[model samples]
Target chain A: MQVEGLSINLATIREQCGFAEAVDVCLKHGITAIAPWRDQVAAIGLDEAARIVHSNGLKLTGLCRGGFFPAADALGREKALDDNRRAIDEAAALGADCLVLVVGGLPDGSKDIDRARRMVEEGIAAVLPHARAAQVPLAIEPLHPMYAADRACVNTLGQALDICEALGAGVGVAIDVYHVWWDPDLAKQIARAGRMKAILAHHICDWLVPTKDMLTDRGMMGDGVIDLKGIRGMIEAAGFLGAQEVEIFSADNWWKRPAEEVIATCVERFRSCC
Target chain B: MQVEGLSINLATIREQCGFAEAVDVCLKHGITAIAPWRDQVAAIGLDEAARIVHSNGLKLTGLCRGGFFPAADALGREKALDDNRRAIDEAAALGADCLVLVVGGLPDGSKDIDRARRMVEEGIAAVLPHARAAQVPLAIEPLHPMYAADRACVNTLGQALDICEALGAGVGVAIDVYHVWWDPDLAKQIARAGRMKAILAHHICDWLVPTKDMLTDRGMMGDGVIDLKGIRGMIEAAGFLGAQEVEIFSADNWWKRPAEEVIATCVERFRSCC
Candidate 1:
């Protein structure tokens, strides 16, 4: 019953259960691998969270996030860098495989994406040493283009690779199907990431046709329009045999369901669709 | 005073007025160029709409759309091709510069984006001879990636240009800033588009920070995070001197405002921001 090469990013059941309870549900369903958000870890206190994770002998696929470097002023930018350093420390303590970073988008009242991108590069460079010292690899998760204004400006695999190349060894990419399934250059970029050995994580979810909400409303594995097997094939070809982390942020449907049902469904979908 | 080199895509005020009224407002504001949707033309009858345009010598920047090729079955695909041929004829009748194609996304119940993209290319190729005979160019509008699932699978300038190159002449690209702004390779691709003379239309709209709705939360030119002047400079540098067509789909905000105010703001933003 062990679901080989599969991990549940706890955000899928964040609304239904806390960190400890979500882990219990995952364990019940034979899912020993997981990725947890910073807030989720903080809620249970990092020490207790680490203790539970260690005692259960669970595989920590990745830590939820740490990036949003663009800011309007010097002080704001410095604050973001400081926060990312703390996240690096947390990832190290948890023994997570990598620290996923959703690089921030445009600053307030700013139309200059190029400048914001430059700020992102600078912020990452500033934190690289600390992340390396903590033995945590930084995974830049390029968001969908729709989130380019408010969520994350890094919106392409190639772009993320470019940053990885610039930042050198400590940085890599988190390839999420929800954000990148439509990319025409997906095959080429995955190959590039593989050549550079920059693919750190693989995230899975389907893109609903009538995506009712931009931030949420993500479909479960087999329910929508993503070629999960095809993307996984690409990732596997790229030499990443890591867990396919399920990270659905559904507000109306999945979030309202019981935590047990959600985990059960994830296990079923992982076996059947993914 | 006339806002030089500016065009209004009538969808900006589609909720407030019909073809004649929208035209009247545009003319009153000294705007000589406009792009009207097929529905707006059909609502007032194409003959009347054509008559109005001829009487006032209005410049039809580009027809408001014609593409959605992916279909569940052969019948649907054939119907889409037939409809595109009609759209080409209509664009020719209106003396529009080109028939803009929002090339359709994945067929219903399928997750094969590559197949959907092929359908789009074939659909365009099928209609090319007719478009050439009618003396109307086909402009493939690369919609934002956010629309890749249900609207259009062709979501990047490079992808659109690849289709153009493969299909040969009488085909080009419509460079909408709202769609292409987040592309890291935008400048390079715009330059590539220029060298190939593939730039047919330049649509302008701001990307709001907190985009409330995926399909309709488009912001006005100066109101969001897009660098209008910067993108315009790139397009102009790429040898596209056509009017910067303002197209916004703001259902909750701008659509609720008075038609005159919306047009006035468009003109103002067109002057200052773009």
Candidate 2:
């Protein structure tokens, strides 16, 4: 009864359940692979979280995020690198496939995106050695351009791949359909990601037409305008046969639903829609 | 004294005034150029609007849009083309430099952005003869990626330039800072636009950090994080010495202010910020 190629990023159910309960629900629905946020792992204690994973023989698709390297001062940037090192350590402990990084945006009161982007590259490069030592591949999740100012300056897969190519190994990109489905060069960049062997993860979610909230209005797989299946085909064609991780941030609808209903819906849609 | 190189897109004060009044306000503020929406032109009738433009010797930087090419059916597609032809006529009558095209998003129930983009290209090609004859350049304004689903599928300067290149001449692009500022490849594309001589219009506006509304809520110049002078420098260096058309659609803030105040603020910002 296990779903063959699906993973649930725990943020999809962050509002409805903690790390343990979210896993229980995913398991009940035959979804054995999961990606948990660092906070989620921390909440349950990393040791306990690891214990649960080992006991269930669960596959950790990825550890939910570590980036946000850009800051106003040198000290602040160093602090961010220190934090990333810790995140890599946690991902190493969890046996996660990769550590997803939502690389930070502009420092407070700054408009220099180029500088911020340079900072992101530098921060990633600084942590590359530690991440390599820990065997946690750093996955740079290029956020949507709307989030370019406040969230992640890395806004395109091509841009992320450029960083990966620049920094050398121990760095790849997390291809989230929500952030990149609008890209005209999506297929080309995706193929490039495959060529560079820089695609570390594949995240799935639909983009709502009248996306109500910029941050939390992500749609479930089948609900919105994204050609999820088309994107998945492109990813598969690009030589990534990894689990299609579901990462919806629907505050108004899916997040309001019960954890069981959410997982059930994810499973149903993963079959019928995604 | 007239604000030498600034043009007011009437949509900036759209909520505050109609065609005649908006023109009067701009004239009073010593702003000699304006870009009015098609509806605003129609409100006072094109003849009267043209009279005002001629009498005051005002320049039309560009007309406020004509695209929305993708439709659900062939009939709908034809209807869009017919409408675009009419928009060309309006731009010609108004003596606008270009007819800015928002270029439609996905048709009803269609998730294929590639097809929608094709439809946009086809739609433009279908209307090109009329536009060329009318001598009104078609300026494809690559909207913000956030509007890629509902507003414009052409979401990058490079993508717009590609369309322009493929479609041949009589078509260029409206390089709106709000949309293209987030592009990682912005400076390079702007230079490419310059090299191609495909830079038809230069629209100016800021991107508010916590952009409240997707359609409206555009920050005034100097209000948000967009590096205005930097982008302007790029465009200017690219050999585009055209007016910086101030196009803000702030629903809650600027839209609620007096037309005179908004025009004055635009002039002030044009000098100080842009």
Candidate 3:
């Protein structure tokens, strides 16, 4: 039977297959919803990728990403804006629900996070008009604080919501369980996001007790220490009923498995665990 | 000249020297403050440690730590409480300013962070009377979110303050730069902690761009991205003028250096960076 609410982010099977093959695997498992990274869409050519997505009637819950605003200089920042615009355009072309953003972090040799944060706001405002015109929402993914220095300056949902309120429109937040599961004010912030109508996507993954890696060592849903179902309940109560996109960057275990087997496990765990 | 308002957490060079040797190294550099771990103190005997501190008039900013409240069973939890009482007595014997609490994470194999946090509060409340009679304050060190699963559940100063508010007396927080430097509401929360008179200690260390190991790969001050002077300005503005305790858990780098060399570096970095 098709899992109605399950959406597979293409990165889960990116190593096993390319854009076309990953989609076929998801379809075989009856997961019609998917979120694809910009690279995956770019590799197969956006035209063919769009054709496959359209013909199959896939629900693009979100485009994998479109934010990395901080830079060392004006030229570097402009380059970032140019790339974000391209990502926004890709989301628009795919008819994706939103463009997920992993907003950038500190510039090289700089400890001024406050300045970096201001740059993020400025960069978002710069691309927001283009995103709005294309009718693609911007989803700010507040990564875990572990990533605050090198990956994202926006490290909390409340911080992201504050940005959303400041930006006013065409912007919201993506609440990923992996990135935000440890937040002390998670419940309060989820409710606050719902009230602001600022929750754009909900990503799911487990945080391993002995997480072996800082980057690509994500655990499969039921294999780690996250209360996934409880968080989903909070998200649902907060008014987001969108697909629960499974986004895992497990470099060793899942990446080496058969694409079909990984999808099957996700479906099983989503049913039993989440 | 003696370095006033500077303290060395012996763990900075734990791999190099024993407790007495470490204190000797600090004293050689005209450093008069130190925070030693329970194991280090036990290795040298508390009586000798106390005698050394009294002879030299050393300031014990804090006793290393004494909390791991979550356990799978009540017996396990009771065992933890027993250990904590002993830690309190030891801190009292040393006449340390406070007992730092790392607090524990989810009980083994459990995904329930909420339960772990509740256990932390209950454990503190249970131990508050003992700490009070012994005249030792309990400083809740809110660890970085990366350590949330295994080290601490309290990940923000605001959350730490919430627990302090609920617990009422003999409880505060250790604002470590490596842990809380990324908090979006850092300035606001520091001010709030100051208002509550719950700012027990202030620890200093840098957050490296590529933090290698989660537990032991901390950077020395002036070597990473934390805005030390800025944070110090905030702490001072918030009315906290305690020793800027140096706590580095560097396994490969600082740990391998000579004790005197490490102490000298700390002294130089503390004066220049912090």
Estimate, for each residue in A214-260, the C-alpha lDDT of model 1 and write its tens digit. 99999999999999999999989999999999999999999999999
Candidate 3 lDDT tens digits, B30-116: 889999999999999999999988888999999988999999999999999999999999999998999999998889988888889
Best by lDDT: 2
Give the clashing residue pairs of candidate 3, or none.
none
Q: Rate the local accuracy (lDDT) of all candidates.
A: 0.93, 0.94, 0.93
Of the two candidates 1 and 2, the one with more favorable lDDT, higher being better, is 2
How far off is residue A233 in model 2, in Å?
1.0
Residue by residue across A1-274, what tens digits does model 3's lDDT show?
A: 6889999998998899999999999999999999999999999999999999999999999998888899999999999999999999999999999999999999999899999999999999999999999999999999998998898999999899989999999999999999999998899999999998888899988898799888888999999999999999999999999999999998988999999999999999989988
Candidate 2 lDDT for residue A103: 97
Pairs that clash in candidate 2: A68-A104
Candidate 1, B46: how far from true, in Å?
Answer: 1.6
TM-score of 3: 0.98
Q: Give the TM-score of candidate 2.
A: 0.99
Candidate with more favorable, higher DockQ: 2 or 3: 2
Give the share of true interchain contacts found in each model.
0.93, 0.72, 0.80
